[model samples]
Target: MKIAFIGTGLMGYPMAKNLLEKNLELNVFSRTIEKAKPLEKFAAKISNSLSEAVKGVDVVITMLTDDDAVEKVLSDQDFQENLKKGSTIVDMSSIKPKIAIKYGKLLKDQGINFLDAPVSGGTIGAEQATLAIMVGGDQKVFDQIKDVLKVMGNPTLVGPIGSGQVSKLANQIIVGITIGAVAEAITLCEKAGVDGNKFIKALAGGFADGKILQNHGKRMIDKDFSPKGKVSTHLKDMNNILECAGDLNTQLPISNLIKDMFKSLVENGNDNDDHSALYKEIERRNKN
Candidate 1:
């Protein structure tokens, strides 16, 4: 099927490449053309403009930075005018559920289909094509695009219109909190003269063993805070989670504390580091 892929940044680049590798007729665009250039080797049609990228495509998948970026592209005259009727817009960006619901209705009113299909698994998952894709939209549209999404990861229809975002928020909550827990535990281990690496080894196969403890925990031990997922990005997700909690009249006390820790990381210019850099924040706290 013909497809248009937008936002070829860290996650988007690998995802677009996967689609191209599958021999999908793909058009790719990023505001910065350089970011979209590598896909040309895989036979992707790199477009100079959003209009050029999306025109006549059967599917338009967006993996932008945030809600505003997604909205900006979706509302652009180039995108609006060139997107053909009946084609689906699958927004894989992590955004507010309310915003997704609002745009889903707007697009539906214009004979377009919209899916909020945010993902987990970081840049690594995108590269490995193992992301957990939570989709919120019509079942039929989901079935039609299931194979296409499988080229990147597992796609499951969680609910209608906004559920994908809600599911994503839930995923982020667990990730953020666990990162904090792992960071604090590692700090405690090191301060007590215990090796952080052995700490992880000691916990393997226990209930505490998980992706975060193994993968991200190793990142912490090695001081590898490179941007698998950015601190600023996780901070944004934490903020979204709290906002959703507020709307539901619920209190997420631990998430609130974790949000503050992330805020501190961003304010101190660790925004570009991996979210695992929460280890830095915890380490900073223990310094006398």
Candidate 2:
């Protein structure tokens, strides 16, 4: 089946590569054409415009950063008319669930299938083709593209329309809490003069051995503030959580705490850094 992949950033790059390697006919579109150049060697066509990328494609997959970018691409006049009827648009970005539902309805009106399939597992997972995908869409449509979804990652149909983004928000909440806990624990260990590396090793097999501790823990120990997952990304996710919570009138104290912690990290010059840089923020607070 022909596929169009939009946004070739850190996660998008590898996810698109996975699709190409799976031998699917692939076309790539990115804000920068150079970003799409690497995929050209894999027999993937590179489109300079969104219209060119999406035109005549059987499926268009968008892995952009936020909802606005997704909306811009989808609402483009060229994209709206050129995208064939019966084709599906899979959005893997983590955005508001209500936004997903709105877009789903809009696409359905055009006889196009829309699926909100936000992903987790970070850049490493994307590169490894092991990201966990949470999908919200029609069961029949999901079944039709299940094979292609599998090529990118393990896809689970969470519910019908908007459920995927809701699941993604849940994922962000858990990730925020876990990362915050890991940061606090590491900070305490540092204050007590315990070797953070050794402490992590001691807790390797215990209940503390989560992905955040295993992956972000190492980055924290090394003081690597590189962007595996940017603090801004988590900040956006936290905003979505807060908005969703407000919409449902639900109380989420833990999520609220983590959101503030992320805000602190961003204020401390770690906005573009890795989310694991929260450890540095915790350490800074301890020193003060």
Tens-digit per-residue lDDT, 63-173, candidate 1 = 999989999998888788888899999999999999999999999988999999999999989999999999999999999999999999999999999999999999999
lDDT of 1: 0.94
lDDT of 2 by residue, 1-288 (tens): 899999999999999999988889998999988988999899899998888888888999999989898888878898888898999999999889998999899999989999999999999999999999999999999999899989878999989999999999999999988988898888788778999999999998898897899889888889998999999899999999999999999999999988888898888788999999888778777779
Q: What does the lDDT come to for candidate 2? A: 0.91
Instruction: Give the TM-score (vs. native) of candidate 2.
Output: 0.98
Model 2 C-alpha RMSD to native: 0.9
| Candidate that would win on lDDT | 1
Give candidate 1's error at residue 192 in angstroms. 0.9
User: How many clashing residue pairs are found in candidate 1?
Assistant: 0
